[model samples]
Target: MKPITMLALACLALSGCKNEEPAASVPSVELRGRLEVDQEKTSARQAQGIEGEYFRRVLTVDGSDMTLDAFINHYCPADTRDETCQKALRIKKIDDVSGATRFLPQGL
Candidate 1:
């Protein structure tokens, strides 16, 4: 066989034997942040028909499936026309079922 081909074969063999260990599985926990829109900017943002600076708080959680981004998108839609409903929403909890627990003004 050609030198280059032999060299390639040798490298491939070495790589195969390097590491066959299974990847370590780390237990993941759910992290939920309660949304808090800035009161000062609320009026201005509402007038402009846009969202203002908001924050989130970690509510009840028991899993590791839901993420901050996913929770927001699933529960809160940017273009949601229901201003009244939006205003009423306060907190969201990450649950075990959908790995997300959305806690509005009413309840989770």
Candidate 2:
């Protein structure tokens, strides 16, 4: 009886260890946006990574033509008027203009 009880406890613990996070599907399209005047490329990526709380590849944007620093300033300002836009401004490198970039929250 003792062994059975211990086994049950172990099983419960093991089951709890399973990854509970929902599996977020990778984005099929690319993301895009021009940097705001006050932000730079590197700063933008750093901000995005921090905001997302994970290193997501899709978050990285390329061919921005706009620096990360400039975007941060114009879009992600300290006194952002729009909380929705502020939350939406995630970290990412512009990959391709052909499609839209995907943003997935890892819930980290």
Candidate 3:
């Protein structure tokens, strides 16, 4: 084989051997904002003495609601394989708050 042909074939083989993986999908901006707003609303309800102890226990710790970013970092940090965290992140509606809270640790 010609030297140039050999070189081209080697490059093609190397390219095929690349171990690149697909990039992780990031949460959409709308979803992020919605989660933050939900947290804020929960906090407000708690302040008004309307929210229940279960919500207070799950969503708030140290007498404060966990910010959306903090919750995501704590529950679903990068490369986390926890089933509860995955389920929590999948929650899409405000009505699902109860379900999501179930994924969190209680008494904290």
Ordered from best to worst TM-score, the candidate numbers read 3, 1, 2
Global Cα RMSD, each model: 12.7, 15.9, 10.1
Question: Model 3, which residues run further than 4 Å from truth?
Answer: 25-27, 35-108
Using TM-score as the yardstick, the better of models 1 and 3 is 3
Task: Give a tens-digit lDDT track for model 2, residues 44-106.
Answer: 756767332222232233433433334444445465545433434443323222122343455
TM for every model, in the order presented, reads 0.23, 0.23, 0.30
lDDT of 1 by residue, 1-108 (tens): 699999999999998896665633222323334444445545665688765443433433344344454444554555555432243242333332222334533432
Best by TM-score: 3
lDDT digits (tens) for residues 14-84 of candidate 3: 99998976544433222222222346656767898876442322344345566444555654666777554
Which candidate, 2 or 3, has the higher TM-score?
3
* C-alpha lDDT of residue 31 in model 3: 25
Model 3 scores what on Cα lDDT?
0.49
Report how far residue 80 has shifted in candidate 1, in Å: 28
lDDT of each: 0.45, 0.41, 0.49
